[model samples]
Target chain A: MSRPRLTFLESSLPYAVNAARLIVMDRGMFVADFFLATTVPFLMQFLIWSYLYQGSSISRSFGVLSLSQTLFYYAFSIAFGRLNNGYDVVSNLSLNVREGTLEPHLLRPVPYPLQKLADFMGGGVVYSVPIILVLAVFVFIPPVALNSFFWPGWVLLVVVSQILCFTLSWTVAMMSLWLVRTDFALSLLTTSAAFFGGELLPPYLWPEWLRPLMSYNPFRFMISAPAQAIVTMDGGFVMTALAWTSFYAIAFGCLSAFLWRQGMKRYRGAGG
Target chain B: MKKYLLFFRLGLAVELAYPVDFIGYVFTTLFVHLTRFLFLNGVFDLTSTLEGWTRRDVMVAFIFSVLLSSVVDSFTPSIRTFVRYAHTGRLEPYLVQPLDARWVMIARWIRPGSLFIFAIIAPIAMLTLSNLNVHPTLLQAVGGLFALVIGAIVNIAVMATWSLTTLVSKRDLPTEFIFRQVMRLNQLPPSLFGYKALTALVIFLPIVLTSTVPAMVVARGEYFLLAPMLGAAVLVMILFMISFRMTMRVFDGSGG
Candidate 1:
């Protein structure tokens, strides 16, 4: 009798399940992460914006968004920010490279990047539940309402942006193969994303000179585009964002492949 | 004190050996702070004032926040090492040292790269203050500096207490993540949260003492704020000491 052969999906499913299981097991850390990463930041933004928009002739609306809409933007962005986060990918890859753990992964039949992607998706599954719950509160709770038609576009952008975020993170992580340490690189990447991705401030509020950079950055696709899709309810914007995100995702995917190939040439493993 | 100085010197020497890493650290710190400043600029453009906090006042608060963060970042490695030692039962060496065990645990290691944050940000801070026309009196200057020092102590005590949780929980919960997020609250004036939240933060968490009070003391010549800041610092320090003793008593070292 011949042994059964597993397809790509079959092989990858376990990695995702294992990653999700680990996240579920670490309930304490996950809760803390959700609260600190999403809830607290949103609260801070709420207080700041509420105080700023309090008594003014500006009529509650700043640029394209009213105060409540702006709050919803932040609530969605912060939650989706955590949902699409790639820090674990960077940390895990760097640790593997440093410890020469890549040797085993290379020997495995499956591609290393696919394995990592599977793991990333698995962890994201665990995070997406709470993120959806949080967004539900923002959408269903009074004082903030969203058009039902925008939900499909919002979901499409989020799905595409996750791929873009993962690819960008993977590309950045490949640099650890050549660098002595990646702590600085990690910090730079995180700050740049937060600043340029409209996490800290909306694109409408950005200075005119910074408009080009703010519009074209990969992080904008990952963070601001999806948030805007729901709040702005513009089909054209969502389609444009989806197209750009797909372009960046493919570009980064190719770049990551090229870097990994070149890095493997320099890979001497533990003994070298 | 001499031993601590020696440890600091050794850490500095090690940091100096990696000049490239130090430069990268400085650049990254600058980028982070500059972006934060720009974000504040965007906010100020929308409104002239936020809850009576002018752009200049917020800038002052931001500088103080940076100082507090720098101090905590410098000591972060020591806190991590203490947590690791607690888990691995490797704390015996520090315990056997002639120095106080608690001090040894918290001050044995340092990341000297973090000290460069001061050099990088101080000039920028000074320029921003000058642009705001914030010149403190001599006495106000002294009080501001005192408040900053106490603020750092309170921040460190809070982190130390958080790290001590590893002994009781037996899990290396990502205390650094929580610490960093909590520290984010200091980036703005606590008063923006209103009086009730400010009182709660001061009494329970005391994070307001880390930056807001010091900024007010320096920028607005509010010397009366120092008394509450000092009191909070002393109270937090006592709490840290108590937690440290109790946690250490229960620590049956998990084998390294």
Candidate 2:
């Protein structure tokens, strides 16, 4: 919820309120359709997966813990969905390079990445409230678990995982300076989540060969680790997932910064 | 027909303008199909006849989805999107001329994108069924082809109804996703008897006839002789045609 330290008139309160009013008047159907199609199907798929997991052999541990995992998925999936307020750094950079907007942001006090990050986080916070409320209900409803579920290690790991995802995406967006588009590049990062981030289907259902590598994959940190913290109530693997997650975060974050600096040198544009 | 061809060419031209889009679209769709095939692959690997069906027989069932998509492209290109034009007041322009609306609408879909999909669907299904095509009696292939066409017509009608609903309701709830589910139920080659009422409903509710019965006719599966099979298909088509015309009347008359 941290605001970028700039006093932009557009982000000012009066303008913001006006924007919200205009949005409600114009694009309400977009919200209704998104809820019905995307969110409903997401929760439905979660229900079916939880049912199947309980039916399988791991039902003993999974049955007791799976509800929280489902809730975790619902929360994080919504979090991820809300966090991406259609401002993929890569797409934005590609468009900026095309339209010559990057120079203005660069001239500003805030770093471009920081500016984008804050904007996305602010928007994500706005979206997260309703989504978090709906998802949290899964925790308290019938057969809910309320107790001291201490898994600080896992929570920290999820933070690291989100950082790593941000770095990788930012890096790709910066790469747009060098290339016209990064369709394959963006797909490579995002589709892994589709499979492993436990969104489309949980990582547990992956073929036997692919199960163990979930720890190495940066995705599980975003999706599986936080849920694992509550459901399993075991922080044993949380440290490991976090260690790798943070490692990738630092590694990719630096790489992206380096690439951005270097890519800027290659930037030839209609001078602003 | 010529008028429809022009509209279709417009769609085709739009597609051609974006060369890179095809690669991503085709790859993602093909990957989804592959994953679905893999899930079934695991099931078949574990069990036989899927409660009394052969592996190749199951493959035949899966092929129906690709075939249905291909056959229905002429009906609703890109799955109910043509109906989008109809309701958007765009179709008014098409209606203004002495155009065969159906031909112009369907023609918009004749392009490279679906051809890629056709390529993906045919190879795997054909490989599995080709192992078992045993020179069926001429009546049988004809019946299979006939049923397949009927299934496509029904899909178009149902999807047209879906598209028209947007005009009245003013919503877009992943109409293509609905088509995907329909494809899911129909494309899978497994039979669903003895499961429950819902599964039974899949058979005659016209989803299964799109793929299952046609595959059966191709494989000469046991249901080919049954009167209920063909009768159900013909009845579904009649209803679909009626529904389609009614929707057209509502939209065309309503000026929507």
Candidate 3:
């Protein structure tokens, strides 16, 4: 009898599960990681913004209606920031390239990028739990919840943003094939995204001239756009976010493919 | 002391070996600081003060925070190296040497790349001070320098204590991640935190001493804080020494 062949989902599911397993392997570390990275930063932001908005006059100056809304924006932004983070993608891919471990990955039945994508999605599955809890608080809690009519649009923005974030990271990580190190590049990418994506400062607060750049950046779609949609309760903004994110996803996806091919050729030339 | 100086020279040489990487790091540091400067400018544009801290006062705090952070970054061992050494028994060689093993672990992996950030910080600090039209008295300047040295001692002691976790834990925790996040709290004026939170941080972690206290002393002439800051630094160093002794008892050749 012929051996049974596995479907794409069947083949990829194990990789995803393994990645998720690795993330939650140490329960103590997992909790500490979440607390330190998310809770502490969010609390700091809350303190700073609360101090800033102590005066009703200054709250108006921030263009944010109330302290609650500003706090909600930061809370969701930090959660989404964790969801869309790509530091591991860059670090892992660079390590593989540097150590010639790409050979085994290339020879896998599934494509290399697909394997990485599965792994990324798998890890994201573990991370998405906190995000869901955060959203639940905002949705079910009477006091903080905004009865926004743009829930469906916000959902679409979230889906598209994940793909865009992954593609952008993959494209950047491909630089490791040529460069000796990608840590500097990774730092630059993350810092720029945090600034432009409205995690550090909201788009509403940006100067008029810088508004265009903020809107057009890839990171804006991944982080701020989804947070902004819910915070501002703007239906039109959600559509814009979906469109921009999808466009960048496709562009970066293609760029990543091209780079992978070029990198493979170089790898072969160098006996990788 | 001479051997530690040699280690520093070795680190500088190693960093210079990869000029492109060094330059990239410098650029990234510049970009991060520039964005922070712009963010502060945007906040100040809307309001002149944050918790009674004027734009100039906050800028002073930010500059000192960055400077202290750079000092920590320059000398601290990369967490990856620490973990690798622990896992592979590479640290065993250093333990048997005549030098202090704890200092060897740190001195061997110094990243001089962070020092290049000072080049970017100095120019920005000068321009910001000029723009803010703030001048510090000579006494305040001296106090600020003294506070900075004490702060560095506190910060390093805290980190060194945290680094001992690798000897006890089976899996390495993201200690560096926690450290960086905690360090970021330095950027804000310590006064922004509540009395309880500020007291806890000062007594236990002393992170605020690294940036906020010095900034307050220099920018606002808050000389009263200097004595407490020194006390905190001394407390932290003692705690670190006790922890180091306890951890060393359990540490084996490889990760325990």
Candidate 4:
């Protein structure tokens, strides 16, 4: 019997359904997990920054307009930071590779890397959307002021940046293919990304000598670019931000594909 | 004690087998700490102090927090693996051993690798002391040592409590989640929080005893708090032991 060739939509349906099912089944766990993962870190950052500004003049430093403005910056940064979670892809790939399960996956209908990417994006869709919507609500509320020039293009830029964030994280995770032991590399990447990505502190507040390093750094494109777009509505910065983000997205995507191909040639599975 | 030494040697050998991994880990730890130092520098640049805490005072407290965290990390891998053993019904070997199962489990997973954290801790501690305008007396140093020792015990007891919960539930306890919360809270100096929050941390969380109290003792010569902190650590240790025994009893009697 001949089986019908499944279209892209048809093949993607199963992965999408699986993702949606996991979301429904683990709804409560997701809430708590997201709270602990996103909220706690956000609150800790707020606490630290508040203490820094405490008993000091309440004026701007690092281009932040006010304390409330600074808090808003950190609050959304953490929310956007959610898109950078790549632990699952790294752990799952390394475990499969080590256990020799990846050999079977290689023979499956869908490309193995695509399957993994689909899974990553599926989970991302579930986690990042609601949080973004909630932040948008807060940004529009009375106390929290957006830049006067805020427009639809700003939201589109954020969405594109988030997609770039996911691709870059996945590419970084693909380094597991070469290292085999991804734990060390994964932590190193994540720690560096969080620091350089400006999740810890804004890059403007970064040391003057370090500013050149941060300006050219792709990691800054992932975090600070979108943030700048949201806050400063300057046309020139927005164009540059979009350009760098799209450039990295394409660059890392090609790198990841190249690495996967090279890694597959070198792979000899662990025998059971 | 001999068995523990033997286990420690074996653990060190295992960790040292992967030289690249070890070096990478050490550097990552140093880098993480460096970022923290930078964060504090950024803050102190803007203001003279954080809620009345000078740079040296905060630095001392930060080192204590890192030290306590390292101690916990050193021991909890074994505790987590032990929980996995229980989950998979592979705990029979430990149960059949002549020694106490809890003690054996605790001794099994001590990674000598974490001892390297002190490599950073030592130099930072010295720098912090030298940076201090007030010269600490020998008595304050001795009192601080006592507080640190007692604080380590309290932390161990807290870990054991969480590890024991895995046995009772026959599943993994989210020890990492709890540990993260504790570490973040401990990073804050006790002075920053209100009296009620500080009291809650002291009695309930007890991480305050680990870093904040000891840092206070050493930096400000607050020796008066040492007696109560030691007393609290002892009480927590006793409670932990009792809880472990009861949890083991339940595990032994259950078919699962």
Q: Write the per-residue lDDT of candidate 1 for residues A1-272, one digit (tens) a residue.
A: 99798899998899899999987887877887787667777877888888777777366457878888888888877777777778778877876776677778877767999999989888888988766885677667764555566668778778888888899999989877776456666777777777878888888787889878887899988888888877767878888898999999999999999998998898776621
lDDT of 1 by residue, B1-256 (tens): 7888987998788677667767787788778888888888888888887777788888898887887677777887788778877776777777778988777667777877787788777787778777889998888778878988998898888888988878887766667667766666776765677777776777787864588787888887766667877888999999999998998898877722
Is 1 or 3 the stronger prediction by TM-score? 3
After superposition, candidate 2 runs with Cα above 4 Å error: A1-138, A141-193, A196-208, A212-215, A218-231, A238-272, B7-18, B43-57, B69-111, B120-124, B131-147, B154-160, B163-173, B177-256
Error of 4 at B184 (Å): 2.8
Q: Score candidate 2 by lDDT.
A: 0.55
State each candidate's chain A TM-score. Answer: 0.93, 0.71, 0.92, 0.85
Model 2, B216-241: lDDT tens per residue? 77775455423554565566656655
lDDT of 1: 0.79
Fraction of native Cα contacts kept in each candidate?
Answer: 0.49, 0.03, 0.63, 0.25
Which regions of candidate 3 deviate over 4 angstroms? A56-61, A143-152, A268-272, B77-79, B87-90, B123-127, B252-256
Error of model 1, residue A26, in angstroms: 1.5
- Please give each candidate's TM-score: 0.91, 0.62, 0.92, 0.84
lDDT of each: 0.79, 0.55, 0.78, 0.69
- Residue pairs clashing in model 3 are none
- Show the colliding residue pairs in model 2: A90-A173, B4-B104, B8-B107, B8-B108, B49-B53, B61-B189, B62-B189
**Ranking under TM-score, best-scoring first?**
3, 1, 4, 2
Query: What is candidate 3's lDDT per residue for A137-208, written digit by digit as tens?
Result: 866774544445577778878878888889999998988888746768788777877788888778768788
